[model samples]
Every structure is written in C-alpha cells, then in structure tokens.
Target: MLRARLTLVLGIVLLAAGVAGFATAGRGLRTTSVHVGTVPVELVRPDGAAAGGAARPVVVVVHGYAGSGRLMRPFADTLARRGYLVALPDLAGHGANPQRLTEAALDRDLAAVVRYVRGLPDADPARLALVGHSMGAAAVVRAGAADRSIAATVAISIGDDAAAATRPGPRHLLAMYGAFEPSGIASTTEATGAERVVRVPLVEHIGVLFADRTHHETARWLDRALGHHPQRPVIAAKGRLVPGGLSLVGGLLILIGALLSGRTGAAPAPPDRDRPGLRVGAVLVAPIPGELAGVALAHALPNTVTGYLTGYFAGCGAALVAAALLLRRPDHPARPDHPARPDRPDRTARLARPSAAALARAGLLAAAAFAAVVLPVHAGLTDVAPHGPDWWVVALLALAVAALLAGAHALLGTPWSYAAVVALCLPMPVASLIGVAPGFLALISPLVLVLVGLHVAVCAAAGRPWWRTVLAGALTVAWPVAVVLPVLG
Candidate 1:
C-alpha cells in the first residue's frame, strides 16, 4: 500500500514538472552589439558600393547587453544584400565601448549612430529604421520616442514599460518572443503600438533572432514594412509548415502512448498479509553494501576495469531495493468464511485514468518540445545541407521521448512519477550546459522552465506534498537564473 501511494505521488510530480519545464524553457532577455556609430560599425554591408550611392534608407541593428556587434553582422548583411543601407552598432558597454548600461549613455550612442547614418552619402535620412534585441530593443524604443526621423522599429524580446509608452514616432513596430515567456512583456508592449505589431509564435527571447522560423518571418516582415516583396516568397510558408508538421505528429504520438499505457484506471488494492518489515528493510539496505564493495574493488583494479565498472554499483543497488520490496509483502492469511474483499486499487492507478484535459495538456507540451528540437536542428541542417533528416525524424524523436515518459509513468506507477518529472525537467539545464545547436538555446530554455513548472503544478493538483512540488520547481528554474544573472550585468 505504501509503495502504491509512493508511486502515485511520484507520477503526479513528474507529470507536473515535465509540463512546467516545457513551458518555461528558453525564455530570457538577450543582448548583442552592432558597431555602427562613429567607431567603424561592425556591420557588414554586402553591397558596399550601393551604400556609397544616393541616400538609401538606413537600418541600424543594435545588439543586446554583453553581446558584440559581430552578432548583428549576419542580419545587417542580409538587409544590406537586399539593397537597404544597414548599420550594426555595438551598444554602450558592449564591444569597443566598456561603459555600463545607462539610459543617458545608450541615448548618446544611438544619437551618434543616427547622425552618422544620416551623414552617409548613401543613406536616406527620411526612411530610417532601428532593430534591436533585448536591452538593445529597449534602447531603440527610447530612441524612437525622442527622434522623429525614425520611420520603423523592430523590438525583439523587449517589454514596453513607461519609456515605451511615450514613444509615438515609428510608423510600424514589430515585437516578437516565445509563446511561453514568463512575463509576456513583449506581447503586452505590442498592444501600445500605433501601427502594425506582429507577434511570431514558438519563438523564445533569444530564439526570436536566430530560429529559422522567427528569422525568416522577421525578414519577410521587414521586407513588407519596407514596401518590398521577399526575394523568395515561399520561404515563410516552408519554414512554418516544417515545424508545424513535426509538432502535430509528435503531439499525437504522446497522446496515443499515454492512452495505451493503461493509465486511465483506478488504483489497485494492496494484498493482506503480515509482511516482514525488517526483511524488506534489509533487502533495501543490502545494495548499498554491495555497491561500496564494488567501488572499493574498482579503485584497486586497472584503469580499463575501472572504466567498465560504471553500472556495477547501480545494478547492485537496484537488486537490493527489489529484494527489500519483495520481502515486505505480507503473506496471505487463511480465508475467512466471507471471501476477503478485493484489494483496493492503488492511488496511482486511480489517478492514471486518462482525462481529456490531461491529454490536451500533454499534447501541447509534446508539440512545444517537438518544435523546440526541430526548429533549431532544421535551421542548422538546412543552412549546411539541403538533404538532411526530414520532418519524420523530428516527429519520431519527440514521439519516442513522450512514449518513454508514458511507459516510465506506467511502470513506476505513482511513486516514480516524481522522479520522472525531475528527469524531464533536467533537459533544459542539461542542454544549456551541454550546448544546443547555434541560436537554439534561447528558444529551448523557456520551454523547459514552463514544462517544469507545469509538472510541479500538476503534482500539487494531484495531492503530492506541496513542499516537494515547490522544491522541484525552484530547483529547476532557479539554477539558470542564479548562474546567468550575475554575468548578464
């Protein structure tokens, strides 16, 4: 009965964590610099000669905090190649300038860039545009508010606070971020814009800049805003469909797997017997001793033997725990005149009963994860080679992970659910530490945190101890913040 209860609690916790992790992963402000001011702007103009001709509309790209202008070079190049005069400027305290971030300092730098671009022979002072990331985006908004010459603005992963509220000059504004951003600040900011405001879905804070979906959408948006059609008209459609397909298939697989796991049932009953409690305890403890012995032997053995001893101790521990659980079961007593009531279904089994809501939530989570993995991989692969893993690979992988999770929940019942939640929550931090594909980590982080939070919330709803749920959420979300916040400044 205790084992069954434990299993139920574990499963609930795991489910909640998985949901939260998926939701909150890759959601944070990111900044980079583009050196386009008095100092030789790091921006790369693909059409250098074109930039020297008649005054063309100047598009100044600003990087986020702690980021170098080099980061914006690719974007500037893209714009420049399309006939716009593009400038990449490093923000104050980023690249070239080591000054700390301050409203005054940033304004001065922006003013300098504006003046420089206006003075350029090729730049048209009448059609100026500013695009920025994170803090840089905020800077652009501030500049636009004060400068009437600015024609359009693109702010990625930035919120409209008091400063943005006052801005009224830009004819068009584009604000974008991942769907699961904790603050939903970007979306809120977009509401205040007078002109067109676009919100791209499935893009996280950093992902807004680099994820192929977001990147292509951004390029198209810019082109339209600039009164030009995209050179490649079907790019956006192709990018959207690819990730969308992967997410749909992955979500379906997860739902099917959950339904197939017999999770939609009531708890099973515990057998009646005088289980040997101490014997069970010994069975659990025995593995520790065996593991200790193995570790000691590994230290004395050759390096090759030591390398191969990875699972030796773990196997021993599992065996001992299994023995303990087996010994604890009570022996059957003689049947009374009336047959004993059937053992009560365990709590986990009862909780496992599939619900429409649970399935929907799981499907959404699976889709997001599917998108997170697929978009970046797609971008990376597509950039390098035309013939690579197709939509099927992404769908299969996402489905496989979801299926594994569902199976783990079923096998471990409720008690192990907590562990599973922890495992699911671990991916973002693990991915962050291990490094995901280029320009992908930002998109992935927020989804991971959201999933972890969802998992914790689910566990709490399912009656797992409140403290455990809170603890898991805190540990999963706080780790990255603790590590990154200090460095961001």
Candidate 2:
C-alpha cells in the first residue's frame, strides 16, 4: 500500500512536470491550421506578429516518410522564434491530408505548398526557403534544383535521390546529416554540391531532428542564405523531450498500478517453477511464420505501412492460435484466494484466469491508460487524430492484435511472457528495415518495441493476470499502428 502510494504521488508529479515543460516551450509561438487546396498545413510564427504585418522570410519545413507536420514542430518552433515564418504541411496521405500520396504527388504537393507560402501576406515571396528531412529532404533537394527562385535549401537525412537533382546553379544548398548515418548519406548530399555541410555528432536519423546543435546549425544556415538575422536570441526547447518522456512513463506506472491493485495482494508472490530455457527457445522462433505471412501479404495491400501492419498482426494471430492448439492442457481450478505455492507456480497457479467481468475491466483499464499516455504525445509530436475511414482500420487491427496477445498468453503463461511478446512483435519491422517489407516500417518499428516494453513493465509491476495483461497490451500497441500509418484508398 505504501509503495503504491509513493508510486502514485511520484507519477502525478512527473506528469505535471512534463506537461508544464512542453507548454512552456511553446510560450511565444502562434500556430494556426491553414490549407493549400486539400492539404492541411500548420503556420507558425512569433506570437505578437500582426495580421497584415510586414512580410517576413518564409521557411516551409517538411517531415520525413510516415511523419506529419507536427513531427517537424521542433524545427518549426526554432525557426519561428528566430523570426522566420515557418509552414509545416501534411503531405498527401500523411497527417490531416485526405488525399493519397504517390511518387508524382510528393512533388506536386510540395509545389502547391511553395506557391501558397509565396502568396501569404506575411511571407517575403523572394526570400522563400525549404527545410526537409528524409523523404522530405529528397523533395526539397529536387525542388531547389529545379526552381531558381528558391533562395535556399536545407536537406537533412537525404538519400540517393539527392544525386538525381544535378541541376547546376547558384543554389545555396545546406546538407545536414547525423555523423552516425550511413556513409552513403554523406556522399549523396555531397553530390548535390551543397555550399555548407554539417554532420551533427552523437545522433542518427530521428535524433538529428531533436538535437540542439542540429536546430542551431539549421537556423544559422537559413539566416545566411535568406540574408535575415533574428533580433533576439534563437529560442530552443529540445530539453523538454526528456521530461516529457519521463512524464509518460510515470503516468503509466500510476494508472497500471492503481487499476491492477486488486490482483496484486499485499502478500509476496511465489517463485516460478516453469523452465526458463525452454520458454525462451520457443519464443525465439514463434514469430517467424507470422512475419513471413505479413511480409508476403503486405505486397498486395494499397496502404503500404498500414497494409503491412494488418497482415503482420493477422499472421501473429494465426501463429498464436496454432501454438495454443498444440499446447492445450487441462484447466486448473481457480486459486483466487490461495497464495500460489513457490514450486508449482506454473500456468494454473499464476494465471488463476480472471472472470469475464475482470477481463473486461482490465481491457478498459489498459485502453484508458494507453490512450492517456500515447495519444497526447502522439498528437503533439506527430499527426492529428485519426478520422473518416481510419476508425475502420483501427477496429480491424485491434481484433488481430488481441488475438495475437491472447495466444501469446496461452503459450508463454502469465509470468515473464513479455519476452515472448517482444520476440513476436519485433521481426516484421526489422524485415521492413532490410527491404523485405515496406521500407516505411523502419519509421514505426521502434515505437513497437517501446510500447511493448512499457506495457510489459507496467503490467508486471501491477501483478495483472496474463489474459488481462494481453488485453491491455493489444490495445496499447494497436492504436499507434492505426493512427500513425497513412490512409490510402
């Protein structure tokens, strides 16, 4: 009881600190939603700038693949504080945009944004610049090469596409990359004949976006290219990320602990009797079939990332079901009132299998807790809320995820089953990273591991049953897959 009380108090404090930190970072910024045709955009600038004020130099920042305008908020905020009017847009198929994206569409959408920004009353049309990361980097590099009017270009995490933009002109190209990035990334940028190149140290890929040095370097380069300097010091807020993450973990600890307190009696838990070696070995290969199925089926789906996820979860469900059938055994009588004996703490003793009502409660608790922690952070960091046909995808994916979790519980049992969960979930994303699945999976795969670890740790601490834990875990993992991936018709 005392430990739980301490946890509750600590969690509240951390959550408050994180929320306050994020709010403080945005103190002098004004953000508004505007549209370029059907494309949604976030227009960010200094708070006190008047409605029809003198035109300021505009910098349109674009996010990487599977990312939204919000994901590029760090860049937007930094440049806005430096007195640059920044425009962050949801490319076709990403964030709030309702249109599907394609190879040709990326350029078209970027062109639209550029044209619209050039027309903004507060924008200096002649001094327009672009800053893009990854896929967006490729887009801007191509844009800068083709359009002589673009005063400057900043490309971060650029790929082979940079080599293709070979238009030779007086382009003020600034190529930025993490030192830890692949060697090919540097060579590609160099091929563009960038006037300035920066390799931000001790970071790679996503880290480059949040790095303080990366933000500073980008602002400085743009200021030089557009020939504009801030009258005030550059405003930076990368420090808020650490406390925000801490707040998420703390909030989860409180919610899971409180919800599962009924299952975690005051008495100490008994020791495990199951063989650790056998379970570990079984779990290692358990997800292989599902991964194979998902990878194969993903090729046929319209929505690249979400399509792969759907197939992946379905494959996992099938594998879990097969494992359950092969490992079926007699059910143990309820031991709700009994303290599990140390030597016999296998499936029957530990699982004790909660009632239907209890499972429902657990599912509800997990969903609520997962949403509280994940949704706000996701919205602030990435895209807007899922809408229109997105809920249909969420419903379907949730069922498959639930099946995968339930089957995992049946085979691995209640205690230490998180290892199995991680093993089952990680392979598809890795396959994607290596080009076996949709390449975009690399963007979302890390989140899978983080969410899985979070769910396992919180549930384990709260002493929830395998079924209940799986229920919670399924919902927690599924929501991101549904919300983050692009919606294609």
Instruction: Indicate which candidate wins on lDDT.
Output: 2
Local accuracy by lDDT, each model? 0.47, 0.74
Model 1 bad stretches (over 4 Å): 1-40, 51-53, 167-169, 224-489
TM-score of each model, paired residue for residue: 0.43, 0.88
**Clash count, predicted structure 2:** 0
CA RMSD, predictions in order? 16.5, 3.9
Q: Give the C-alpha lDDT of model 2.
A: 0.74
Tens digits of per-residue lDDT for model 2 on 263-331?
A: 545543443325556545556665666677676667455466666777777777677667565655555
How much does candidate 1 score in TM-score?
0.43
Count of clashes, each model: 76, 0
Q: Per-residue CA lDDT of candidate 1, range 115-202, in tens?
A: 8778766567887888887677778887877786677787777754654576464557766665655354565556546464556577
